[model samples]
Target: MNTTPQQNTQDRPARLTVGVVGAGRVGPALAAALQLAGHRPVAVSGVSEASVRRAAALLPDVPLVTPAQVLKAADLVLLTVPDDALPALVEGLAETGAIRPGQLLVHTSGRYGTKVLDPALRAGALPLALHPAMTFTGTSVDVQRLAGCSFGVTAPEELRLAAEALVIEMGGEPEWIAEESRPLYHAALALGANHLVTLVAQSMELLRTAGVEAPDRMLGPLLGAALDNALRSGDAALTGPVARGDAGTVAVHVSELRKHAPEALPGYIAMARMTADRALAHGLLKPELAEDLLVVLADGANGTHGTDGADGTDGANGTDGAPR
Candidate 1:
């Protein structure tokens, strides 16, 4: 879809009226941000009473209404419902003729784009996707952090401009993405943000099993440094025994894991093999060394035993045994 910038408003509009449906973690946070950006959150709705109560507390001046009422009152309707519920909600709204011809319909789901709003589009509404590439921890702290974050925007030609404008108004940089590429982009975010949580949890469990008290304290500095390095140098920041192609050290880890944290072995092996592949791509490991390291990691995956190297020490070359 075309992504030309919308007609620039020299001055911000005086309180653009907004309606928020689904007062879950993301919904209320976004509604709060909209309010901060000089928007009037005129209506709020959600499936659960608790969610509705939460939204009412956040936007006490706004009326708590049914989804249909929100649609009717809002110039811009935000479907902050869970991703799976969005299509059904749009269909229901369209069937009820609640959506106006020129109203802007937006959703916060990262996994989907404007396609989920097909029903709204059929009813002549502008469909837009405005997904902030960040996690919601269900706190005001998260809402405060929304400023200057990157948002993934996708929509039809006419709606794309509106989507970009909205994101900019929210103090976020808009990254235009093809509608069909939303899934891949979401997956990348999941890998980096969500899976990183999984990896750290697994590592912490391993450390706990190894008798490390206060695992969080021990991991904090190490993770902080690693993250800083990754941000500054990308893949070049890789380190540790796996990046070094130190087969002997890896074998030691496998043996210790088998005894201490067998449950974490599979994840360790998977991440190690993936890291080895990255190291190879960076030319840090010779093909033979990479193959050997892969074998060790694969053995861990398969619950099998493997020798680290011929000499029972690290591999022959110091370069092969140093961290990448």
Candidate 2:
């Protein structure tokens, strides 16, 4: 791994003794990568059966010990605990006088930057946030998958070179994340990746309710294509009744969803309404068509606009039908 630019090629340490503070899904995978990079994974801390298994499998023979012992044994410590647990863990460790001056303390929480490690920093340990922008499965295979991922790095200006090198050695690119933007960056990822999973699962369940054979298999290509198109074409990839302004088809859709899958009806209507809004905003749907689609979605399968304007339910009697 490359060293700090301030250090001529020769002044840098050849390797660091790394301690893993938690052998969760992220910790062992990172330790394995650092091991492959020639760093020593000296010790790890874990309590759960799964955590123990993962550490043994990925960092074999690396001592599984108490958190204090792990900290004492290493020059670089990686804290991979849950986001909520980290601040307390650091503060507790620092309070016990486990953290030391000149040691590197790093955390892998996407939602936080080095600021959360204030306890360690106060104790004179250098702090760094090196969050890999990818999920982990707590397997050795995850180490291999790190090759193309971006790590959202937040480090003290003086310690940046060391942090970047560590990230690079673990087979990731370091994308500098400012301290204040960590939350927004993390939010975007959750909205896209996590929500996509929920949306897809909802679709799969709906297909099962429709009595489709092997619904997952059936959805694979269609969902894949839709995702690819959406990514490649942005708002232009929108399709279906909302985009086409087929109020009649959308009204029928609401009727069927309400009849067969009442749970999914609200979600369907919400998505349809949002899609129509986006389609209009992006100029993909003409104003007249957008108005009609919005009315139908707002009023539901009654096949009528609710009288009022955008809300369609402001106070309108449901007598006006969608434009024929």
Candidate 3:
């Protein structure tokens, strides 16, 4: 009787040797995850002090070598360099004749799809684009986070199964992204995840400046519930004064931010306008109330509050009028 591929694993080698080109926060964690999936990590290349430390911690005993050496040693080579450096690195590797035929060349860049690896593909290497949606701390914790993280995957049609299988082996869910859609997909993730960090940090700083102690503690539950609600019910989760079309409350907020956190005023006004538009589109903001709210936002945007004094200060409350 002929043995199936699954049963024939005992007769053939099972583990693919993994290599990392950049020992950045993302690379070593991924290599560690692959190690847990029974893959052998043979080599990693990183020049910085931080990279050396991370690689040692995450891939202990895996020899640190050059990028070309990494490609030479492993069956699956992870190109975990920065997005901007990826194209050049691939070209250089292909030019130097480092890439082997049948080698798996995987990159964890959200920006580019498989096209960036065409040079490597022309060298007879297989291309895989697998971008993890989660942030990394350059620690073992990243490995655990992979248990339910989503990976934005793009590959040649013939290699789709192979790409998804690699994602699953690293304990990630595979979310297929079209080659042409990679840029938009990456932009959406950056808009959400990256901007959320900025927003949260700004909110905490504003709270601190407003005489609040333990701002993190105060915002913890509030932000958590807000995030959960927004995730569960998108536009319907719009709340607060902007969503309710409370022109007076919004005006007061703009006045206070102008008085206290002038630097934050622009971002506040921009997000409020966006929120107001979304609320109007969702029918959450009443049309009758939207007119005044939009005017307030417009005034805020133009650095002309409805109640500004001659000094360009929001004179609704008497205080220093500095735009600083």
Expressed as tens digits, the lDDT of each residue in 104-191 for candidate 1 is 8999989998888898888999899999998876667766778888999999986678788888777788999898999999999999
lDDT of 3: 0.89
- lDDT tens per residue, model 2, 111-208: 99999899899999999999998878888779889997899999999999999999998889999999999999999989888878888898888888
TM-scores of the candidates in the order shown: 0.88, 0.85, 0.91
Which residue pairs come into collision in candidate 1? none
Instruction: Point out the higher-scoring one by TM-score: 2 or 3.
Output: 3
Q: Distance from true position, residue 211, model 3, in Å?
A: 1.0
Measured by TM-score, the strongest candidate is 3
What is the model-wide C-alpha lDDT for candidate 1?
0.81
> What would the per-residue lDDT of candidate 3 be over residues 163-250, giving only the tens digit for each residue?
9999998889999999999999999999999999999999899889888999899889888988999999999998877787667666
Give the number of the best model, judged by lDDT: 3
Give the residue spans of candidate 1 off by over 4 A: 1-13, 308-310, 313-324
Query: How many residue pairs clash per model?
Result: 0, 0, 0
RMSD per prediction, one decimal?
Answer: 5.8, 6.9, 6.2
Question: What local lDDT score does residue 28 receive in model 1, on the 0 to 100 scale?
Answer: 79
lDDT of 2 at 77: 95
**Every candidate's lDDT:** 0.81, 0.83, 0.89
Over 4 Å off in model 2, which ranges?
1-14, 301-324
